[model samples]
Target chain A: MASPIIITPAQVATSRDGEVVMLCLSGNWQITASPPRWEQPALDRPLRRIVLQAAAIGDWDSSLALYLSAARTWSGQQGVELVEQGVPAEVGRLAALLAPKPTPPAPQPQLADLVASVGQATHQLWQETKDLAQLLGECAYSLGRFIRGQAQFRWRDCFTEMQQCGALALPIVGLISFLVGVIMAYQAAVQLRQFGADIYVADLVGLSVVREMGPMMAAIVLAGRTGAAFAATLGNMQANEEIDALETLGVSPIDFLVMPRIMALFLMMPLLALYADFLGIMGGLVVTASILDIPSSLYWIETKSIIDLSDLSTGLIKAATFGLIIGLCACLRGLQAERSAVGAGRAATAAVVTSTLLIIVSDAVFAVIFNILGW
Target chain B: MNTASGKSKFAIEVEGVECRYGERVVLTNVSFAVKPSEIFFIIGGNGCGKSTLLRHLIGLKQPVQGQVKYFGRDFTHADRAGRQELLRTFGVLYQNGALWSSMTLAENVALPLELYTQLDRRERARIVSLKLAQVGLAGLEDYYPVELSGGMKRRAGLARALALDPAIVFFDEPSAGLDPITSLKLDELIRQIRDTLGTTIVIVSHELPSIFDIADRVVMIDSGARGVIAEGEPNQLREASPDQRVREFLNRRVAAVQQQQGILHP
Candidate 1:
């Protein structure tokens, strides 16, 4: 029997006691003769005792399976005695394959190896890949469930979500867009004055603010404000098992929990973006009127002419799209959040990342479609 | 028990239910019935089909092979409205207590009412405060779940369970991680609810003390191949002769190590 390629941490907890037991490769545990080359020595040094653990691994996928297979085989030949009772799951699964015990002892059970089983190291790899695929599928399925529940949603909950998206977020949206407008107008003044095309600054400000800047700024602000807020709120709920609780309670989580949030963003975002557009243009109007000595009436006339219904509609459409993506991503990340305190931070970060990425991608798609259609 | 309402007369019948996840078979050919108004306890080690069995009772999981009937209704396959109708008559307390952390105590307690009922906000507030008070969290209604201790959160969760005045309440594990004192208090609360409302209760627990304290009859599941090995009043089973599995379970020992006396007395 050749020694299987097993590289485990030199030590592992093999008993139910709080004590950590030692594993001697040659004496206590040994390689066995098997076609698949399990670590068990089937004929002579029948693997008398072993302990398996899930997190205690020192090898990649294949090696981990072989090590587990070896432990399982060795245990099988000897009726599966254990030094690691209440064994961790990874080890528990491995031991289970051999012993076939209906009620397998837990990885940390007192009789160290008393019917213990553990998973192979490959299980972690399997879980990570599986979880990602599962999350994506869950997202799509959740949306399907979402669409069905929309009609049945309680209007009051929608009001509460809209209230938060509008009332609570207004201050931040107003403050930031106001600041951005101030900066844009200041930047436009410096650049336009240099070209002696100072009067044409109206064209530049009106077109940019109405068609692009207004909606873009609004979406970005929301991504930071409401987007982050949605993710954090939902993430905390996920960590606390509130989502699962809702399901157990016979509440349609989508109608009761999500519809209001989506509705809130849908209503507030475009409205806020429209407000930002007006404020942003006024900023440019003020700067031009004061510094360049252009009359306020002239600035207003030029803005009205350059910023038509099409320009305003384009920006509003972009704001609406961005709103959906930002809110969806935030809530998705939140609902999919992890269980730890750090998971909250991670969900917030993921919400920001996913929202920003969606924003840019969506903007690009919108631009192309508009250009093709000559909007 | 008051016995004022016959709601406690509804029984939970889990018949020949089978379920599997992909290739892994989690439950196979399992069956049991929970009597009305009596605390029925499901006791098993982890992964021994304990939670899966509970899901069936609550219509969370539909059996592929058989069905679960709640008071003679075809519950396992019921639609949302049907399930919702059935749910209105009962309460469920999950294994983790599943409180929404974002909402305050009062808000969380009021959620179910807010969902299915048309009570005004003030009315909701009044009922929420009353429920919280029942759980000894009266003034703490504004506290978030994170702000409260584990025991407090569980109590708040209990208040939410009792929010709608259901005819029965189901608990996943009423004393999982709390200290013994808190666990005992929760048990006493369970007893009090039963005494007061005479509500039919189904509890899933492995804690021996809790089982002996609140459960009227304990159903013990041993292995996958072995269905239910024992089902009787906890005190009766504790005193009566039992199979080796039942005896080991009652004594909280490793069943495999002990041999059956096999005199056909059990």
Candidate 2:
């Protein structure tokens, strides 16, 4: 029968002799055991050399290498010679691997570099603007081709996109518009009640919901949902070489991929805005009935009287324009995406952010135009 | 001593495997056995289910109707834990290397060792260094996959695949994107790994020089036939295979080069 060998804890002891520092490493130096702590010897004396004595060291692994490398680094920094005595060949080799290699320093930016970067950024932005305009022109040309029945457009794909852009979006659009209606009606009720004119809450909610809130809310929601999806899907296809495959087969990506999505959104956005208007008005009716004691029939009659064809048409037209903006921004970012996973993610984010900004800016422009035209 | 059809002698055995995606059948009635320490090659035309068959062999996808046995144990029917135990012995190199873009080469190689072994950090680092050196990628351990060239990336991926000293290594189009010299070097490395380690190797490739250079036995799968059309030594198949398609595929490069030279010279 063999006896079991007893294990020993690792130890590091430091002693000074003249200008040389002696680091004594002993006992088992396995990583499973707790490592020994050794404080740095004082630098008061001019040290010429440091000796690592591992004569009593037992079975060891990376822990010993780690200790030796630490000593080596300290000696290098202190401008002293390091001497290894009786160390195993394996430990020496492992310790050598731990030695740090020189790396090139990163360049620091200067004033001229900053100016150059700014100039480069401006040039990139100008180029991107031109690309966006060219994409829109290509889309218009493909639409012309479709009208003449000469484009490679699939009705099935267009219908699928319509379903995604319209039907699947209803629940969220309905929810947000309904909440907006409730908030607006509550604010209106607070003020109108002061004058005992609570019945006019119907007129306020109806006009605003139909003219401004409905199209804006629906467009914003679709910008985040459908636009980001378009960018991500196309960006991934680009990464996987599927877009290149389509191009090699003589198919125009604008006619095949972009046209269907844009047409779907253009046709569906007005319908979605109309649906949102109805839901928002219904929410206002609920609030008015409960808080102001107004009957649903009376609220409906007042709402109908206040909201004319002009208000409805204004919201629908804004919605259609917003839809076009979202589609163009998203598809352009998708087509322009670099072929990588990170590029796909950036494309999706850029699509959502850019489309939302454009939607708000276009809505402001429409506000000015409508005001000037006295619609 | 021998029972149950003597399947234990072979390293891998596939019986009547059928591959399909939904209702579209890709391959049917595929059957083959690979002996221990053999270098086998699966060759086929583009989009001909060579990759699909490789996927089945590696237990990535289940065959609709058939059995895949690894060392006489049914891999297709193994439970999660049992399948993981079986998978630990296998290493697969994908067509594009597919090294994690975020990790450095050393970290990529160390991942499998960290997961599967109880080796200490120093020991694992030593093994990682050795494997990279074997693949001729030593001293570039800190380089990320995106920083390396395509050939270097593939070699690093091979190093990672060999991290655990797997019993069987699978290569999918190992020479797909490499120059001829680099691919020939890779073929040499593959043969060296087999000879030194006695590891079973199964490669999926259509590169003709690679097929003839390293393959001990070759199987040709035809897109139209939807199964293995011929199986034998590459040289013998070119000379004597009854299937005209097999002969044409094996001798395609020679005729292609000759016709190209004729056109250029004329």
lDDT by residue (tens digit), candidate 2, B1-266: 01123248887888999998668899999999888789999999999999889877877568999989877889888885667667766677877676755458898788677756789999999999999999999999899887989899889878987887877788989999899999999999999999988888999999999999999999899989999999989999999999888988898834455554322241
- Best candidate, TM-score: 1
Candidate 2 residues A1-375, lDDT tens each? 998989988888888999998988889998888877545678898889888899989889888888887888788887889899989977877777778989899888656677888999999989988988999999999989899997878677789999999999999999999999999999999999999999999999999999999999999999999999999888876775445434422357898889999999999999999999999999899999999999999999999999999999999999999999999999999988887998888999999998999899999999999999998
Query: Chain A structural similarity (TM-score) per candidate?
Result: 0.61, 0.87
Task: Name the runs in model 1 displaced over 4 angstroms.
Answer: A1-160, A167-195, A282-300, A338-345, B1-10, B20-23, B61-64, B102-107, B114-147, B222-229, B235-246, B255-266
TM-score of 2: 0.58
**Every candidate's CA RMSD:** 13.2, 20.8
Work out the TM-score per prediction: 0.68, 0.58
Deviation (Å) of A271 in candidate 2:
0.9
Position B149, candidate 1: lDDT: 85
- Residue B71 error, candidate 2, Å: 50
Error of 1 at A369 (Å): 3.4
* Among all candidates shown, the one with the greatest lDDT: 2
